[model samples]
Target: MNVYFHTFGCKANQYDTEVVRQAFADRGAVVVDDPARADLAVVNSCTVTHTSEAKLRTFVRRLARGGQGLETVVMGCAAALDDGTIVALPSVRAVVGGADPGAVLRAAGLPAEASLPFPLSATRSGGQGVRSRGWLKIQDGCDEHCTFCATTIARGANRSRPVAEIVAEARLLAAHHAELVLTGVHIGTYGRDRTSHDTRRTTLGELLEALVRAVPAVRFRLSSIEATEVDDPIARLLIEAPRHLAAHLHAPLQSGSDRVLHRMGRHWYTAATYRKRIEWLAERLPILGLGADLITGFPAETEADHRATVELVRALPFTYLHVFPFSVRPDAPAARLRDQLPPAPIRDRAAELRELGEAKATAYRAARRGARADGVVSGRQGGKVEVLTEDYLSVYLPTAGWDLRPRFEVTVD
Candidate 1:
C-alpha cells in the first residue's frame, strides 16, 4: 500500500502521526509524499476551532474527488468528537478517533499481527533518518477544563506515561536526533496522576532530570507548558544547564484580562501571577525565547479588556506571540456563553495583537545578529540550509559542511 500521511494541530498530533507512519512502514507499506500517487491517505485531525474542522472536511472531499479516488482515514481529535460528520464525508474509509496506531493499522486493512503498540524508536522519513529535533510524547490528554478548549473533550483526562518508559524512549530518540521536544496535551502536569498510586511521586522536573542524565549528549526542549507550572527545579535547569536544555519556553496565556480568563475557566493563575513568573524567567536569561498564545475577542470581552491585554504584551519581553481569534466550538462551554463578540471585532483584535507580536519578534532577532548560539540544521530553503538556533530563531547558512555534525554553532544574521 502506498500511504500519504498529513497531520494537523499541535506537536502532540505531529508526534502521533509520525508514530503511525513508522507503523505503516514496519508493515511493508510505501509511504509516499504525494496524495495523487498514493492508494490511501491518512489525515490527522484537530478539533480546536470551527475553522480547523472545516478545513478537514474540505481536504477530505478534495481527496475523494481528486480523480485518483484516494480513500482517507480520519483520526485524532475531530474523529473523536465529531458527531457523525467526519465519517459521513465522501471517500473516508474509516475513522479511528484517537492516536492509536493499532486501530489505525486495522482500519487500513493491515494484518492482525500489526495490532501491538509500537515502541518509541528512532523515526525515519522515507528511510532518510531522523530530521532535526525528535518529538517525544511523554503523556496524553489534559486535566484542566478550560471553557474555551475542546481538547479535554476529545482526549480525555490527563494520563501520564511511565517514567522509566519515557527515559528509555528519550535515550532511543537521542541516538539519531540531537534535540528531543517533550510533547503532550499538558506536559507541565506530567506526573500528577501517579501521585496517589505511588509513594515516590515524579513531576516534570524529575523526568527532565532523568532525561538529562540518561541522554547527556542530546538537548531537550519543552513543547508548550503553562506559566505557573514552571517549577523551581525546571527553572534552575534552564539557568544552569544551557547545554542540556534549551533556554526557551512557550507558555500559553489564553487571555491577559483576568475577567476573560475567569470566564474561560482558566482559574489556575491570574494575569498578575502569570506576569510575575514570566518576568522572573526573562530577568534570569540573557536571551530567553519567550512566547505565549493569546486569544482575542472572547465572550463578553470589552475594549478595556483588550487594552489590558495589549498593555500586558507590551510589559513583557516576548520573542513571539501566537495570537488566535476566539472561535466558538460547540463542544466547549464558551460557545453557550452570553455576549459573544462578533467576527469583525475578533478579526480586528487578532490583527492588532499579531502586528505587535511581529514587531517584538523582529526586535529579538535583530538583537541576536552577532550572537553565537547552538543550532540544529532544520532543512534547506531557497538554496541555503536553515539552522534553528537554541533561542528559536532561524539562521540561513550556506549548504557546505552541513553534514558534518548533528548541531552547528551559528552566528545569527
Candidate 2:
C-alpha cells in the first residue's frame, strides 16, 4: 500500500507524521508524495486556532470529494477536538488522537508495536532512510491554562518521553545524517509528569545537554519555548553549543501588556524579563535568529495594549514575528470576555505588525552579509540554487559543484 501524509501545524505534528510514515514503511507500505498516487491519505490536523480548524475541515472535504480511491484518516489536534465531525466526513475511515500515533497506524492496518531503541554509536548509513533534518518530539501536551489557547483541551496535560528513549531516537536521526530538531507542544514543561521520585526528572536544559553529548555531530534545534523557560543555563547553552546546533530560538510573547498577560492566565516572565533574555542572547551569540509569536485583538485588548505590543516588538532584537489576529475558540475563557475588537481593526493591527516583521527580517538578513553561514542547498530556482541555513534563513547561491542535499558552509556575499 502507498500512503500519503499531509501534516499541518507545529513541528511536533511534523514529527508525528514522520513517525507514522516510519510505522507504515515498517509494515510494508510505501510512502508516496502525491495523494492521488496513494491508496490512503492521512491528514495530520491542527486546531490551534479557529482558522486552523477551518483549514482542517476544508482539506478533509476536498480530499473526500476528489474520489481518488484514497481512504482518508483524520488525526492530531483537529480530530481529537472534533472526532464526531471528522468521522462524519464523507471519506474519513478513521479519527485518531494526537496522544497516540500508533493508534493511527493500527487503524491503517500497520504494525502498532512500540519502537525499538537504537544506540547512539550507530553510523549515518545504518538508519532507515535519508533526510536533511529531523524533528524529535521529546515532549508533548501542555499544562498552561492560557485563556486564548485551545491546545490544552486537544492534547491534555504535559508529558515527556523518557530521556533514554529520546536519546535513542536522536541517535537514529543523526545516523541518517539529519539535523535533529527537539519539538513538543510545551517543551519547557518536560519532566513534570514523571511519577518516580528518583527517576532524575530533568529540565529541557538537561535533556538538551544529553542530546548534544550523545550525538555530538548532529545539529540540534529547539521548537518554541516559553519566555520563562529561557533561564541563564539554557541561554549559556544556546550561545556555547557546538556549531551544529542551530542558533535559533522561537519564544511566544502572546502579549506585551502585563494586564493582558494576567487576564490570559500566563504566570511566566513579564515583558521586562522577556527583554532581558533577548539582550542576554544578543550579547553572547553572533548571528542569532530570534522569532516570536504574538496574538493581537484578544478580548479586552485596547488600542493602548496593542501599541505596547508593537513598541515592545520593535524594541526587541527579533529577526521574525508570527502575528496572529486572536480568534475565539469554543471552550477557552477569552471567548466569553467582553469588548472584542471588530475584525477590521484586528486585521489592521495584524497587517501593521506583519509589515514590521518583514522589515525586521530584512534587517536581520542584511546583518548576515559577509558572514559565513552553514546551510543545505534545498533546490534550484531559475539558474540559482536555494540554500536553507541552519537558523532557517533562505539564500540563493550560484549553483556549481555543490550537491543540493549535502550541508555546506557558504560565505554570505
Candidate 3:
C-alpha cells in the first residue's frame, strides 16, 4: 500500500511527521510523493489559529471529494479537539490525537510493530542527509498558560528527552542536514522535567553547550523561544559560538502594550524588558536577524495600544515580523473576554503590520550588500545556488556543475 502525508504547524510537527512516515515505511508501505497517487492520505493538522483550522478543513474536504477515493486520516492538535467534531466529518476516516505514530499505522491497516529507534540512516538521503534541513525534536508540550493560546490545551504539560538521546541523533544528522533546527513546543522549558545528575536544574543554554561540543560541525538554530527565556548566558553563547549556534533569534513579543500583555496572561516580563534584552543582543551581535510575533486587534486593544505596538516595532532593528490577526477560539480564555474585534479592523491592522514588516526586511537585506557570509546551499536554480545564510537571509549565488555543494562560503553582493 502507498501512503501520502501532508504536515502542518511547527517544526516539532515536521519532526513528528518524519517519525510517522518511518512507521509506514517499516511496515512495507511505500510513502508516495503525491496524495493523489496514494491509497491513504494523512493530514498532520494544525489548530493553532482559526485560519489554520479552516485551511485544514478545506484541504481535507477537497482531498476526499476529488474522486481519488482517498482514505483520509487526521492527526495533531486539530484532531484532539472533542474528537467528535473532526471525526464526525464525512471525509475523515480516522483521527489520532497528538503525535502517536502507532495510531496512524493501525488506521492504515498496517502492522503496529514496535518502531525501531529512528535509524541514524533515516537522516541520510542519496548518500547525503536530509539534503536541505533537519528538524530534531528535543522536547514536547507547553507549561505556559497564555490566555489566547489553544495549543497549551491540546499539547498539555512539558516533557524533555534525555540529553544522551538527542546527542546521538545529532551526531548522525550533523553529517547530513546542512542546517539543523532544534525544535519543541516550548524549547526554552527544556529540562524542566529532569533535575541535574547532581540535582541542579539544567538550562537550555547548558543543553546547547553540550550539543555544540558533541557536534562541532553542525549549524544549530532554535525554532521559537519566549523573550523571557533568553538570559545572560544564552546571549553569550549566541554571540560567541558562530559555527555551532546560528546568529538568528525569533522571540515572540505577542503584544507591545503592557495592558494587553497582562490580559494575555504573559506576566514574566513587560514590553520594555523584552526590548532591553533584544537591544542588548543587537548591540553585541549587530545585523542579527531579529524577528517577533505581533497580534493585532486583541481584545480591548485601543488605538493607543496599536500605536504603542507600531512605535516599539519601528524603534527596534527588526528584520521581519509575523503579523497575526487575533482569532477567537471558543475554548480559549481570550474568547470569553470583553470587546471582541470585528473582522474588518483586525484584517486592516494585520495588513498594516505586514507592510511595516516588509519595509524592515528590505532594509535588512539592503544593509547586507557586499558583505561576506557562510550559508548552506538549499538548492540549485538555473545558474544560481539558493543559500540560506547563517543570519537567516535567503540569497542567490551564481554557480554551476560539480562545484556546487550543499554548504557554501560566499559573499552577498
Best by lDDT: 1
For candidate 2, give the lDDT: 0.78
lDDT of 1 by residue, 1-413 (tens): 99999888999999999888888898899998778999999999999888889999999998888728788999999999979999999999999888888889889998646446547444564464437788899999998899999999899999998888888888778767888899999999999888765577799999999999999998898999898999998999999998888999999998889999999899899999999999998889887998999999999999999999999998999999999999999999999999999899999999999999999999998888899999986667566787778788988877775674769798988
Instruction: List the candidates ranked by lDDT, beginning with the highest.
Output: 1, 3, 2
| Per-residue lDDT value at 335 in model 2 | 88
Q: Each candidate's lDDT (Cα)? A: 0.88, 0.78, 0.81
Ranking by TM-score: 1, 3, 2
TM-score of each: 0.97, 0.91, 0.93
Worst 10 residues of 1 by lDDT: 121-130
Better of 1 and 3 by lDDT: 1
User: In candidate 3, how many Å is residue 36 off?
Assistant: 1.6
Please write out the lDDT profile of model 3 over residues 1-413, one tens digit for every residue: 87888888878887878878777776787888777788888889888788888888888887787627778888888887744777766568889888778888887777675554555234644322226668788888888899889888888889887777888888888777767898999898888888755266677888888888888878888888887798766787789987678888889998889999999999887999988988888889965888898999999998788888899999988899999999998768999999998888888888988999999999998999889787887666677767888788887867644364667676775
Candidate 3: give the clashing pairs: none
Q: Model 2: which residue pairs collide?
A: 124-175
For each candidate, how many residue pairs have backbone atoms clashing (under 3 Å)? 0, 1, 0
Top of the candidates by TM-score: 1
Per-residue CA lDDT of candidate 2, range 43-127, in tens? 8988878888888888878887764777898888888878387788878899887736568877887766664323222233213
